[model samples]
Target: MRYHINFGQNSSSFKLAVIRALTGILLMTALASCASQGAQEAELAAQEAARVAIEQEAASLAQEQERLRAAEISRQQQEQAAEQARLQAQRDRQAAEIQARADAERRQQEELQRQVRAREAAIAAVEAERQQKLDRITALEQQITSISASVGDSENNTEFLQQAISVAEELLDVLASEQEKYEDTDSQGNTLRPLAKDLIAELEARKDELIRRAGTQ
Candidate 1:
């Protein structure tokens, strides 16, 4: 009976040791599964952070390119405006030069017309003066012829003879005065001075003859 009881106690102790070993193995497997899951989550977080950084860098580069394009457009607009202003100034100067030339030509034409009119007026005046001088000379010659005829008809009457001598003396004085006025030669290289001198001498001789005839009558 003592040997059978000792074998029963040894069987119970061996069962307890088997239960302890199984519990320890289960705890180790749970710890290893948790470690592997944590490593996978960390790798996924690192990939997400890299993608966000790349997107932000690309957006910044696009903004820089837009700014450069705006500045170039503004510079081109300023250059076009300057070139238009320069062309406008050149056109204004050319217009002013054309107007000045036209004005000078108009003034020159007016001056030439005035000179032509003045020359025509001067020629007409000279012709009128020459006609008046010719008329006066013709009248003087007719008066001298009439005086000589009257003197020959009245020689026998003493009172008429004396009057004829007085008239002839007045005529001789007029002819001498006319001769003095013709000091310069005419355009034809002749003068009325010699004819006036002959008339004066003839009248003086006739006046002397009339005085002697009147004293005898």
Candidate 2:
């Protein structure tokens, strides 16, 4: 009986030792697997972070390009506007200059002062009709030289003194027809409107030959 008891105690101790060894091996393997999983997860997280940074950088580049394009367009628009304004100003200046010139000759100096006052009123009405035909030809040459020297002595009625010598030779042919009408002349150098109507018909034929030689003296 004492020997059997000692054997039984030895068997129990061996079984316990086996159980402890198995537990230790299982725990070590589990720990190694967990550490490997953690390493893989860390690597994956680092790769993802790099991808996100690349995407953000690409977006920034695109935005910068768009901003530059918009600025260029705005600058071009401003340049065009400035050019238009310059052209408009030039046109206005030209128009103003034209208007000034138009008032130009101020109606060509009022039409040469109305043709010098109508040629000085037609030369003062032809010098007042040539001084009234030179004062009726100096009073008909002093009455035909005093009736041809008083009808050559007064027996006066030889048929009324021969009709008073044909009425004093028709009053010396009517004062030579007013000296041939004041010596003619024409072509606007005045004088001939038929020489003032033949000097008013030789002063009415020397007043009818001095009333027919004073009715035969």
Candidate 3:
């Protein structure tokens, strides 16, 4: 009876031990499955973070490219503007030079016209004076002829002396016209003097002779 009771107790303890071992195996399997699921979730989260970082990096690169392109375009535009300004300035300078040259030419033409008018006036004056001299010479010649024809008469001699003094004064007036020929170049037309030097000397001699005769009379 003692043996049988002992066997029964042993059988009961054996069954309890088998049940405890099965329960421990089931708990270990469940813990392993939970660990595996956590590991998978952590892996997915890492993948998602990597994708987000890559997208951000790509966006940053695209924005940098856009900024660089904008900067380059702006620089090109500035250069074009500068080139346009330079060309405009060059055109303005050319126009100004042309205008200045035209103005100078106009002034020169005006000055040349003034000189021409002045020359014409001087020539006219000289010609008029010469005509007056010729008329005076003709009158003097007629008077001289009459005086010589009546030379023996006493009244005629006195009249001849007075006529000679008048002729001398007329010749003195002509001397000033001849002097002006040298002073005013426009009057000197390729000759040293309008009248010959010998003719002037003869006239001077005639004047002195006439003056002496007038004083004696």
Candidate 4:
């Protein structure tokens, strides 16, 4: 009975050792599984953050390109407006120059017309004056011829002869005055002074003959 009791106690101690070894192995396996799961979750979070950063960078680049395009369009519009203004100013200057030339030509034409009218009026005035002088000369010649005819028909009458001498003297004085008006020649190129001198000589001789005849009667 003492040997059997010692064998039973030794069997109980071996079973307890086997149970402790199994518990230690199970704890180690659970710790290794939890660590692997944590590492996988961290890798996934890092990938998500990289994708968000790339999207934001692309958006900023697109905005910069749009701003540059708007600035180019504004610059082109300003250049076009300036060019149109320059062309308009040039056309206005040309129009003004053309109007000035036209005005100058019109003034010149008006002045020329005025000068022509004045010249025509002056020529008409000269012609009228010449006609008046010629009519006066013809009337004087007719009066002298009528007086000479009456004197020839009344030669024996002493009163008529004396009157004829006085009349003839008055006509000679008038003819001398008329001759003084022509220095060189008349308008028709006639020697009016020489003809008037000859008429005065003939009238003077006739007046002397009438004076003698009056004394005899």
Listed in order, each prediction's TM-score against the native is: 0.41, 0.37, 0.64, 0.44
Q: List the residue pairs that clash in candidate 4.
A: none
Q: Which should have the higher TM-score, number 2 or number 3?
A: 3
Off by over 4 Å in 2: 1-30, 98-217
Model 3 misplacement above 4 A: 1-15, 139-217
| RMSD per model, one decimal | 12.1, 11.7, 5.9, 11.6
The positional error of residue 84 in candidate 2, measured at the CA in angstroms, is 2.1
Q: What local distance difference test score does each model get? A: 0.63, 0.61, 0.73, 0.65
Model 3 lDDT tens row, 10-82:
8899999999998898888889989999999999999999999999999999999999999999999999999
> What TM-score quantifies how close candidate 2 is to the native fold?
0.37
**Tens digits of per-residue lDDT for model 4 on 195-215?**
454665566576656656665
Clash totals in order: 0, 1, 0, 0
Candidate 2: residue 198 Cα off by (Å): 37
Better of 2 and 3 by lDDT: 3
Total backbone collisions, model 3: 0
lDDT of 4: 0.65
Displacement of residue 135 (Cα, Å) in model 4 is 4.8
Backbone steric clashes in candidate 1, count: 0
Please give the distance, in angstroms, between residue 203's alpha carbon in candidate 3 and its true position after superposition: 12
Task: Rate residue 210 of model 2 by lDDT.
Answer: 51
Best by lDDT: 3
